[model samples]
Target chain A: MTAALPDTKVLSPGNPPLSPARIVVLGQDTPFRLDSGVELGGFRIAYQTYGTLNADRTNAVLVCHALTGDHYVAEKHPVTGKPGWWNLMVGPGKPIDTDRYFVICSNVIGSCMGSEGPKELNLVTGKPWALDFPVITIADMVRAQRLLVEYLGVDQLFCVIGGSMGGMQVLQWAVSYPDKVYCCLPIATAARHSAQNIAFHEVGRQAIMADPEWCGGDYLNKGTKPTKGLSVARMAAHITYLSEAALHRKFGRNLQDRKAVTFGFDADFQVESYLRHQGISFVERFDANSYLYITRAMDYFDLAADHGGVLANAFQVTGPDGKRTGTPVRFCLVSFSSDWLFPTSESRAVVHALNSVAANVSFVEITTDKGHDAFLLDEPEFYQVVRGFVDGNAERRGLAARVG
Target chain B: MAGHETNGHIRPDLERIVEWVQPGARVLDVGCGDGELLHALVRRKQVDGRGLELSMDGVRCSVGHGLPVIQGDADTDLKDYPSDGFDYVILSQTLQATRRPREVLEHLVRIGRYAIISLPNFGYWRVRMELLLRGRMPVTDRLGHQWYETPNIHFCTIRDFITLCDDAGISIERSVILGAGERPLPHPAASARANWLGEQGLFLLRRN
Candidate 1:
């Protein structure tokens, strides 16, 4: 049931065994039944661990990665040679102190960084899944993570946390297994994808599909990659991650390596140059088809819709006989002031729903001009909020702290 | 009354406020300074406490102590909170500092089942004596700043607060007075003597 694929090593050539982390492979007998009703037979998950699981395994924290992020949560990324995406908040004495808690971050199912995605080979077809890959939802991603956690032999998670798409997964994890998650932290995320967000994702998908090199989502078989389309998609999506004030403060009409505008179609502004660099770097690391699948999954995520249109119903824990259990996972929601994509209003809606059900919850909207990406940056207020919430929950869980 | 110790001593007014809060009730403390009262309630009464702090440092300090608090302005943010979302909404010594004291009072009663408010009384004997003798706005220990520098723009006496509550159709369920040292005053409830002698006024009110 758990046999390894013969072509697993050659499947993701670009990944190249970057981080010294564990990679688990699940076979046909242990298939991942996705929301699309398609069963994914053989798949692999790459993950990194920090700190140590306590003797009772009560110190485990699952950190979900965002859309373009990988399992390298607090170390150097093997491919780009850049510092881990969340290094500012996941080190010794940091907000999510690895010294006190065991952290697990896995590259999601539809991601390309050493995970089961469109880039992985289909055991039946003996080729990449590509367009043939079943569309996955946020719930499917959490289901895969649950498997990973169970395989690691941890019965319960002390906390599950993430921001943006990762936060969506955290919410799904809490709802799907209310008793298993002790504390939930979903930052800068919504219970459902807004129409505007879905529209933006549609544009990105269209950009990739427009490229001739896409070759009907079979670029790998044709020995070509849709780098240009993927770059355009990344460039457009990256703009939403920042606020106008931050763009003005950083680049603001300044020329790019020139004293004056080129007066041509070239990148004449510093902002344009920066976005171009971001798009180029993104294409080098991400697969075009994988982006399409991941964005689609996010667009289809609506936690309340799956549970009779009542958001509180999504948090209800039921027994095997389908009776109410009356136990809820504690939640702490956070949002930034300037995050237009997933604003504070969305977090408030979640809080209001939790209140209706009498769930133990806390919410804080940190004042920041860093936009949606503020969660990834070194915002002092954000760090203090996370540290406080995590430490408080840890105390309540009776997990021993690391003494100085 | 059991005093919740933080820095080895509980501010007497805060101890009184904690006593008013029922154990296991959901409380929202508006303008919670450093979340001291909420912290005490959570530790002593085991209440589900939340805080809305206006100052960044206060929010940080509250969060540093692992208290749930959001950095927000009372005058604007209160409208966003759902009605009857909390069992008790407490505004401790921040009413006069708000841009719209009357509107803020209305929001407190609207958002919580009971609104617990504690405010400095401007009609205290020391404030009156200083104003009559010196012919200027008083500078007592409670109201220390001069008029030009004071944040208490809409400062009121106990009588004035009662009249405003009556005008707004709100019912005062209970009231208490505290002297200059933040200890309970022996004056009878709703008496003119309490207005003059009491340095602070604590009221529990609800919508009529």
Candidate 2:
């Protein structure tokens, strides 16, 4: 089944707007099966790699991106005309710098990007898969990425780093392949998605489905899009990403364009205009059906389920020799003070679990007004912490050997 | 006690503070669980290190981690550490929960070059609202444990902490009020809402 799929050469967002790292395709023809029993005759992964792979292949770093991010960790995005989401921290001289480590970022299987997703053609039906794509879990995403890593001829990663949903994948990578990852940094993430977070995602999905043009997630053929619903969904979700103080600072009581309120729902405030822009721009590159499927996948993520109900059991992983492990996958958990969605407490719970397993863990409570979005923005202190860690670790790896 | 070797992995917060220490500095950490900071200083910064901790488990853990630590209570063990042994006796976030902060401060100043202290600010507007309006101990992301289960014994406002530092004759050399990942915090309001708006406070001090 995996062999039937076509080549994936044009997946990179290049030229005009931004030059995002291109997705490198791999895999041979045999129906690649997912955890959900859904199979694809051919498989292609949209991936971007940075730095040079050493002869021994030990200096590779696998970075898993958040739900909305793509394979553009340090490059610019062509459609958005903006720098990569994490450009502030990953570059020639920055932490997680492309020059020192071979970094790989891939679009998840259920995403709207080059990877096979809800919009891909279904072998069973001659049309786009749409909602027919099998429900993929966070673990499934990790497994698919693992196969890609193997295809790249790499067996171990110097570090697995990410934040938010990407952080979840980092944790999965460490636990699922303890021998493969030397250091694990899962920032601003928890062992599992919280109930409140799941609730928020549900609201966004409902808002998208309620649009008159949704047509049950098959709006592509209707020549009409669920613009309003998708916009509202984006607006609501966007609120969760920012703090009240950040909003107040960015677009306080200022009016959209007029001095006084128009006394109508026509975006009277600047925040309204900003939110509308977010909604509109979001719909351009995103598909509403893919949003539904991806959010649902995040909602179902329960790391402890694979290792009984005890979260600690997940950390008590063994090495290849089955002895009590050395290093035991040390972790660093960072959380923002204003991040009401996942919050610092959620990160603490994960830290406690790591501590219970006697794993080396350091937790930081970085103060930020940007709320959950703090992870994406340019926070000097945050970057310093990351820079210190990455630089110190890189030195230990003797990356300096390559420099001189 | 076992002979110890230092691994040089200082806590990020402490890493920032170590740069301010004078040469041949002597330091003590109250509630110094596992002696990571002290061990790092001894190994990398060439400082004399000692720690007073209440938990036997903590002392043992520090011992196992190749750090030299004594299992004793911070509130009662100052006399054993002797005067002038430490040039800078540090209290990082342990000032709040001590049984006698006043006595601890007095003893800390007597035994070291100065006492570097840090704590969360209770006067932050959010804490006030949590107490006044929420009608329950506010469970924020920073202070997540329930009120009854919390380890914080001293709830000093930023103003209170500084005033106490002044009254104790501890001269403040450097202070940093850390806001979450990226928010900017002003120097004047460093103590006032740092507990609520910021995550923690770091200070360098000496006897006036």
Candidate 3:
């Protein structure tokens, strides 16, 4: 392990004990050789597993996380004391019902959580890698995940599932290691990054870079963090994660603290307060440059283009000689009706491609005002769909139903 | 069909069809919304089941429920599925909505050992009464949509379906008229009037 890297987990304050979460950290000794020529060696993946690995290990599910998510898929977050991103759909009795299938969720590479990222120091330089870290892509992220799974001795994953950036990883997993995944649930994602999404990411990048304190991504060493810039960046990206209807329902024309508008930049509106809260809370645990690298990776994701111009080719369910090795990746895509960032149209495009190949694919458009974050929110309908699907998959394998 | 389970133990018509499916039988269902029937077959009947569906929501729900369902328009995409990939092909309540029923039926029979099909009978008394007295499309519980907007592109009676099957050299293995849920009415004529003039036609067919 790099001397500059912390020996233990990223134990943040106010966070609960890791024991309650029971994350079995892997990748501590073997580093993944990245396609970018740089190797992230001695990396440790913090992950938690629910359920038994059935005799064949075919019942394991790989749960990928979105940009800011860590390995805590259904546990409580250590820093903010919040529940894991998809807790509503992934607990003992929940839809993903960890009781029936072995669920493994790890923090992605280039993340601030126990994973290796730019925020960690380089052993040679005795300084945080920061901008010195090699640029990674969504495909690279999936490769790292594959290594983690291989280390765990799981040959074929029953399913790979995630939403938004997590969904991007799910798609890459299916394409890059087709034989490993039996089913894929990529929610609120597109075949490729849209111009609009790219543009929004650009605005956030510019926000981070414009800060004088950013110091060419070396702000951490300078003891002068780019808090303002990163906060603004978070605020902007947060809006894209929500629908107009959700914002209206949550904030609307309501004032923040006082009765009337202060008529200044003092966050007079409730929405402003909410955004600021999101930004401030975000900056407390996240590294600004790590966000830059992860979002850039997402921006560069183009699954169909990588396989071929034909989107249908990505959905091919078989290898040469009609073998199931390269194919048999059943797909389930879910999109929220009000999610403007990655709307139902984006999901439909994926579904259409799967249809062209006559792939075993299913798509669900959850009727919710919660927008892109609906997958993470407390929506019973979304949970029901997920629970039904997960349970259904378990039953198909002749596995006895585990009481959730 | 008559000696099947009684009310409390009354099996869903789809389950009844699945119950008769031989173990390990490869089956494909058209317009399989949410794959409830396919899931049942795969789980209880131990059948290798796959399905084609149009609604993404249905596909998603079915897939989420862990069924092998593909999101595709059955009217045009049926040709893409491999021939003889299934022992039994089914088009339950979805045949009437297809743009070309005859073509789909032809494709279904050509691909499977047998095909199970069910459709709402349009010759039921309510439809006839609506056409004769009201002069408008009947919006009954079985056929719920208004005339111009319904997905039933090719409505047919039990007789029409039988003739098509016979003309295509397909033999009817079992045929029944179900009233309401699973109660069997008489023979072919029962399809014209049941459940106070609402009827459902089910057929188990085989290639001659």
Candidate 4:
């Protein structure tokens, strides 16, 4: 790392966070064309499941993972060996309640961690796809997921839920396959990527490209790795996931294991060391090329632009003034007050769009100092909202509890 | 009447508003507080209900009980809804809390086929007596806050509201002014006694 970035180790983690037990290739029957107009003959989708599908198969809940997330929603992470990222919300007797409904979470097509992405080897050339991988968007990721869900013989998903980029996928699922999704929860997300967000992603992308070891996205072929670049990119992106208040509350310019500053190119601050560990650990389970591709995918997400500049039209309704046939899907949008990355206003815009059609929708902005990561952490109000919404939707769908 | 509770159980203000909502009607309740009225209407009439509350506590409570509630301001968020969008747009005891009660009232009638609004009367005998006798802002069960920190702005008398309806071309389908026990008074809103006797006014209106 340069003097600008903190450094650490990456070659220690075992299993690399890729669970080989659940991998399925889709698009075998026909070619799959993406939003970028690129066609893929076939690709793999890595996934994990919880609970059991009812006899009618209408009890499936599809959980979409965010940019760095994988299919491990309620299980042990194969990478960090820590608990699943969403364990607080999606476990037995929890908000999502594995005891009741069948839940499926998949790594998006554009990401790594066993998913078919830029880091994977091309079947034709037998080399890592790297930059050669076809550019995929959020809709493309949902399309691949739709194929996988179809392959599983499920006609409708009971609920589609996620946060951040996962939330974007959730919106895409509701819009793309309207009939397939019965309910959706898009949390801490926007209908379109903001310019400021795109700028942050651009910085991360440029850092990886600037690294000499990146080698034009062919580091794997040359028996080299872009560890420094990927770590730096992770370091930069991680800061945006939090707020200034959260940063101050966490580190607050506290010195790191010393009385005073060493005045050298070392981590003199606790925050720097914490970020260093975060960046260092992230690179071990992630691929640099995959980071480039996923950030690009997020930068291109604009649900309104695809539907003639009216965000409401994207949800099968015209503008707020238009006559409404109403959407079949019930939606619950959520946001955190401290999340500057995807602020409460973005979620409200989606809520207003839904309200325009008088669609069945609910929205709540939970007050917290924890920032965007609050969704993954323990927030009682957010938890209660999820539980109530999920259970309420279940009650309306006429799905009875198999137990009790 | 099967899901209905005794009138003595709920607050007097919501009990009257809840009685006006018909079964299976499409409804939007603004400033719904903790959604007590919507909750009662949903349980009793099974109305296809939605609520807009301004406070996070209110939203959390409403949503936790399986109600479709969103956090929104009555003055600003009302414009986003389409005209004739709901069967009934309810603004119960919340009009005075708004910045533009007139524009908000106009939006309510425009968006819904019918609009039901209730407001605490400022020209009530107690308020007049409180000013003439003590020379201080009145604080009663209806107007529960002090003047310094009260959300009750645009406090209007029944006569003032009737004149507002006439000025805005809104047709009042029914107007009920409740007295000390929240009992519906025999005197109508246009009657001279309404300004002196009634504690609050509930109006059912439509666009002219």
Candidate 5:
């Protein structure tokens, strides 16, 4: 391991202790080779596990976090004191039931929240990597996850699940290591980022970079935080996560704590106040440079490009007869009705590709006005579909149900 | 005629249709309501089965049963599917509800080596009797709605379907007519007497 920075506190304030978070440090001998061809001498991964690994370790399920998500999937986030991001969907007797399966969640490499990211010390320079950190891809994130899974002494995962960027990692896992994953559930995600999505990400990146306090990604070294820029970026991106219908139903044109509009450009409207709150609260626990790196990773994701131009080529698994017998990995894809970001058509395209390869796959387009964020909400139908898929796949895998 | 025993009840038409489907075949059940036939095929025939349903609730119910089903319109979505995609394509009791029955039939033949179709016969004696005697649209157990509220807009008889198949250059591999109570007719389905007496028609077809 390299020397720790003397003033690590200068990079990020309110740094929580790493007690609840299980940290794994990979040394130079087992360096994590990134898609950008640059690798760190040493780095650490912050993860959290729920449920106990069965005696045979066959019940392990790895849950990948989305762009802004961390390892706090089924517990209160240490930094925000808010319930876990997916606590509604994962818990005892829940869809991803802890009583039946072992669950593991890890903060991706290009993220904050104790994971090795732009805010972490570079070890060689004894300073935060910041802009100097190499650009990573979705594949890189999955590769890092594979390392973590291997570290846990699990030969194969019973299931790998995620939504949005986390969903991309699930796809990458199926493509990169087909035999390792028994079941994959990718919700509201695509094989590649759409042009419109990339455009939106670009706007967020520019907002962070344009901030005067950013100081060429050396804000940490200069003892300045790009709160305004990061907040603006979060506010802009949050709008895309929701639908116009949802926004209308949620806030509409209602005034915020006033009888009439102030007309002074302050948060007079409820929607404006809501966006402002979302932005301000986002900057509290997130790092600006990490956002830039992670968004770039999502933009570079195009699984089909890696395996020729045909999307079906990504799922080609040869059998003993030397014929394309399709992949053994069973997949369940889901999309939301009002999600313009990743619409139902995108999920259908993925299903079509899987069909072309004759792969075992299922698809569901949930009717909801909740947009892309519906996966994160308490949608009963989504829960039912997930529970059915997981339980059915578990039975097929001969996993005995755990008695209470 | 042995009835197709399902939950102790005999559905001869569905049983006759199931008999034509080869074991371990790849099947796509278009307009599969609640996926009863597809599930039975998967369980009994050991065939790899998929389904396309029009109603959201039906899709949900089928998926809840662990069936691979997508909510899609048979009229428009069928054209997008690749040709020769499955060994068998089935459209059960949903032909009259489709906007373009002939087009859907063409797609079924193109997408699958064999197509199985089942429909309620509008020319059955009881239906004709209700129309002629009461001077109104028939409302029987099979056609269970008033004309204004009925979903069966393109209802056709066994004779009308045979003529349509002939015009479209589709060859009927086999045909079976069921009585008013879903019992198989004793005579051949092609005979004119059977068409007037039979309440339902099941046909297995292939492209010429």
Candidate 6:
């Protein structure tokens, strides 16, 4: 769901100090190559970290951001002046517990935040990359995060955690860098974007492209924002993140502060007003082209297809002799019962794959009417499961106790 | 039965279940409440243990204890696993609660080289006496609940369980009949004596 953002960046009390951090992970020595065969000479990653890395650096937890999320994990968003997207989950005593483990979150390469994306000026042409930025994938986003993790001198992340599109990145991290991840938590995500998933995203993309002010993806250079189209896109996409029950419970056919319907499509219904607000606020921080790129990246994600059509092969590494070895990383997969966006079947598929390989894995389908946004809300059961896994793994890892 | 319990605390009944498991073997604990039995097996045998629990609380607690557990039903989810996927499949005090005990039993033997199961005996003297005298479902310490409140649906005696195993072509490799307080009742076979005397029965079975 489009996070109902509060217009203040003042971090919650007792949070660890953070420096606005940015690093160039892909440069001339190693050009950042796209899956589509284009190579950018240099690209940077903007990241935020909470808590402190222990002397051994084994306590670092990498928190991957979702489709429209940026680096602000537990603090305020620089652009919207709102609380970071995951402030509820990554606080000092929250499920992620920044007091005990170092937490890092970054804007994905194709996002419109501080990171390099369609909004950034191209070094060569000195204009916005826009649609010309060359498409990126989930794997590519993870490759950049690997560099950031290494740049921080962390040999292995204690945990890699995310939900929704971020969950796809978590799964990619486990598959791509088996040794570097001790444990992984991929919640409310699928190994492959389903046909319906792609369809919904396509509708959002179409909304942006249909807007006349979009200037054919050159709106940035033309000094115009496709606010109407982007807002509509956000409004339509927001529905998928919530359940029909939640929508009905929250608004139903309730009128938006009126005695009766105005009868002229001026958001007479509260749901319409809520969605309009979601669309309008989204345009202020996100770019239309970047949304297109990221959604396309999610659509292209099919872990099974990448591994000769066997989902199990994604978690197993092939050695020089063509022998397959299992990964050492433990995994905990969670899905909300009402999350039709990333259904329990998707998590079950991943669990089945892990089971086939005899990989250590845990899974739960939590009952909630909050739908796909359940992970972002105050779900005690979800937190208990995560905290149990994290704390339990910490015990096994012999990681230090919480600072509290 | 209570789980492996709080930090470093282990249950005796779960410990008894652990004794039947081999070191380094793969195990699937079907109704792993808080994963007490599975965790014990993991700690004692270092087995690659996995659990399936119906309650979200149990699943979370099991995972919290560092055991790999999934939330699922025993009746439906058992068929999802490949045949002989684990060395041992455990269904302790959980068979009677299943909607289809016979089908679940068949799945147990098919999915594991050996299936370890424990259930309260319906034919025990106290249960029979309670029914005969009070004309009500027995509320023994093991059973613990009134008829309406209990999850137990397909209550079986020691002899009944053996008969079901025999009908399913499963061989009973080892067996124990426990009275009150986790003590083994002195009974030789799945006879009327064992069925009537034991409060609960634990058995290790293999596919024929």
TM of each candidate vs. truth: 0.85, 0.67, 0.80, 0.94, 0.90, 0.90
Q: How far is B105's C-alpha from truth in model 3 (Å)? A: 5.2
lDDT of each: 0.84, 0.72, 0.75, 0.85, 0.85, 0.86
Off by over 4 Å in 2: A1-31, A319-327, A401-404, B1-208
Write model 4 residue lDDT over B1-208, tens digit each, in one string: 2122342366676777777877899999999888788878887788988999899898988787778899999888988888887999999988888999999999999989999999999989999999999999999888989999999878899999999999999999988899998988899789989889999999899999
Docking class of 6: medium
lDDT of 4 at A83: 81
Question: Mind giving the per-residue lDDT tens digits that candidate 6 earns over A189-231?
Answer: 9999999999999999999999998999999889888999899
**Candidate 5 residue runs with Cα over 4 Å from true position:** A1-19, A27-31, B1-12, B15-24, B79-85, B131-135, B164-171, B206-208
Candidate with best TM-score? 4
* Model 6 regions more than 4 Å off: A1-18, A318-326, A402-404, B1-12, B22-25, B39-47, B82-85, B129-141, B144-150, B167-169
Q: How well is each residue in B1-208 modelled by candidate 6, as lDDT tens digits?
A: 2436544556555667887788999999999987777877877898988999999888877886678898889998887677777899999999999999999999999889999998888999999999999998799888898889889988988888888999999999998888767688777656778887888888999989
Superposed by TM-score, candidate 2 places the C-alpha of residue A116 at a distance from the truth, in angstroms, of 1.0
Would you give me the overall lDDT of model 2? Answer: 0.72
Judge candidate 1 against the unseen true structure and give its global Cα lDDT, from 0 to 1.
Answer: 0.84
Expressed as tens digits, the lDDT of each residue in B159-203 for candidate 2 is: 777788788777777777766652446754443455567556667
Chain A TM-score, each candidate: 0.93, 0.91, 0.90, 0.93, 0.94, 0.94
In order of lDDT, best first, we have 6, 4, 5, 1, 3, 2
After best superposition, candidate 4 residue A147: deviation in angstroms? 1.3
In the order shown, the candidates' DockQ scores are: 0.31, 0.03, 0.38, 0.72, 0.40, 0.53
Using lDDT as the yardstick, the better of models 3 and 4 is 4
Q: After the best TM-score superposition of candidate 5, give how far the Cα of residue A396 lies from its true spot, in angstroms.
A: 1.5
Worst 10 residues of 5 chain A by lDDT: A4-13
Put down candidate 2 lDDT per residue, A1-404, tens digits, no spaces.
13222222212223212334445444444566766887665555677776667667777788888878877777767567677788876766666766667777888878877787887766567787887778888888888898788777789887888989999999889888887887767878888888998988989999999998998878876668898888888889899999999999999899987989988899999999999999999988777887888888788888788778877778776557886432456566677889998788788677656644545555556788999989989887667666655554565456643421
TM-score of chain B of 3: 0.87
Better of 2 and 4 by TM-score: 4
Give the Å shift of residue B32 in candidate 5: 1.3
